[model samples]
Target: MPEQGKKNTLIVIVGPTAIGKTALAVALAQHFSTEIISADSRQFFREMEIGTAKPSAEELAAAPHHFINSHSVHTLFSTGDFENEVLKLTEELFKVHSNLIMVGGSGLYIDAVCNGLDILPDTDLNIREQLNQQLAEEGIGAIQAQLQAADPEYYAKVDQSNPQRLIRGLEFFLSTGNKFSGYMTNSKKERPFHIVKIGLNTDRTILYERINHRVDLMMQAGLLDEVKGLESYRHLNALKTVGYAELFDYLDGNIQLPDAIALIKQNTRRFAKRQLTWFRRDGQIHWYEPDQLTAVITDLESSLL
Candidate 1:
């Protein structure tokens, strides 16, 4: 039997992108009669739909979801903000329900809510201005090199093309004389309730096929049009993401449309691989194939029972 006074457990559905995480999360939430909290970084922005692979209208209507399309592209939000907001929201939800669902591919954001991360010092506006200037002038490679010099270990593991990661790494190294990765200690916090982490995966080939197909679906769903809409904002950090970034190249005539679409699929495959690599390191999570929905729900119910 479950212990008395123990608040409801938080069920986290996490895996690589386009792995049917949102569908699985909605299914689980509907089963448990609870709400969902999105851990996806890009889905928070209202403008990124096709690229982010956000929940469809039917799925959103199937269950109550929070934190999806809640912010604008111009807003400055971080994983830290997500952590704080999710924690508060979960606490409030606990008042009425014992089980809540969170789903996304952003491993860092998921880790933030599951295990509290260190709150770094605020960014100096001047430092940010200087970094932005250097980023634009020197390009992403220069910032990546700077990060490598400061935190070689992190540089090896992080997505080197990501300007936000590179800029933040350099900022922390310059401001505090420490690697940004050093602050990422996965120390578990004392949560008021328990947590059950469920991971969704499949054979590598199957997962890759799913990813390729998903990219195709996104393209058909107006991903190119969406990218064109945000073309002017390509200079922003959010636009530096995979799908949009590659399409921006197409728009700039750097690559043909077909080639750009190919690159999107290729890069998306790579991103999924990285996400799996990140999630695989955690042995505590219960893994399953997306097809094992009923069995997973049964297993989870058994655990909580």
Candidate 2:
């Protein structure tokens, strides 16, 4: 428990995929005797269990968790949607718990909740549809090139393979005639609670190996079948992710199963690299090896003091 008269705390555990964030968050939640809110955008859909690497039954049971499999793929949940919901949820949770845990690799969603997102003008739906049509016809590379020319700053940071994000960036530029990255004020919002960010990482080679092994495990766990089940929804923005998108290509006869699996591993590694780049820019995060849970707990205690 926090010391008397101290503000409530939100302990955010952020790292790349396959970096053991779920276990660490659960451990911290148990120690603090509080609940956790998941910031993982991929794990928001209940149908994407195998591919998203969601927490196992045992892990979820080990600690009370919110926002894990809390929505359907059909729902269009945005960063702003998440920010509003989580802020409200945190207010309710803080009424009884002094410390709350949020864990995920989605840097944008994390930033949305921690620092309020900049309000951009509503995008023109006609422009958005046109961009989506272009994406469907010319592939991600075409729109990616557009974003690179229009807004190199966000292009450098965004996951280039994600069509939804590419379209959003392109639509923003087309609608406002300004770079999407420029709209981001990067200003921190004052929250009612204190925040402590803990980042877990390890050697890049080791991280890649872990990612490869995890993908293999996912394949064994019926990730292919899970993708098959969602074939009808492949065009949805929710399915425009690394694992699902690669496998969807295989199902469409665009690539072989083996090639698709390999691409998933490669793309996931790239995603991890991008995640590291995003989090590294935030100097507020305290870095540690994934296994350094004891040291992290000690640091958290001292910070709360």
Q: Give RMSD to native, each candidate.
A: 2.3, 1.2
Candidate 2 lDDT over 128-210, as tens digits, reads 98998998899888999999999998988888777888889999999989899987746778999999999999999999999
Clashing pairs in 2: none
For model 2, give the 10-residue run with minimal summed lDDT.
180-189
- What CA RMSD would candidate 1 show? 2.3
- Model 1 residue runs over 4 Å out of place are 1-6, 121-127, 156-161
Could you tell me the lDDT of residue 8 within candidate 2?
A: 96
Top model number, lDDT: 2
Model 2, backbone clash pairs (residues 3+ apart or across chains), number: 0
For candidate 1, write residues 15-89 as lDDT tens digits: 987788999998998998889999988899998888988899999999999999999888988878888899899
Q: What are the TM-scores, per candidate, against the unseen true structure?
A: 0.93, 0.97
Q: What's the true lDDT of residue 119 in model 2?
A: 75
Give Cα distance to truth, residue 201, candidate 1, Å: 1.1
Which whole-number lDDT from 0 to 100 does residue 293 have in model 2? 91
Q: After superposition, how far is residue 204 of candidate 1 from its true place, in Å?
A: 1.3
Error of 2 at 188 (Å): 2.0
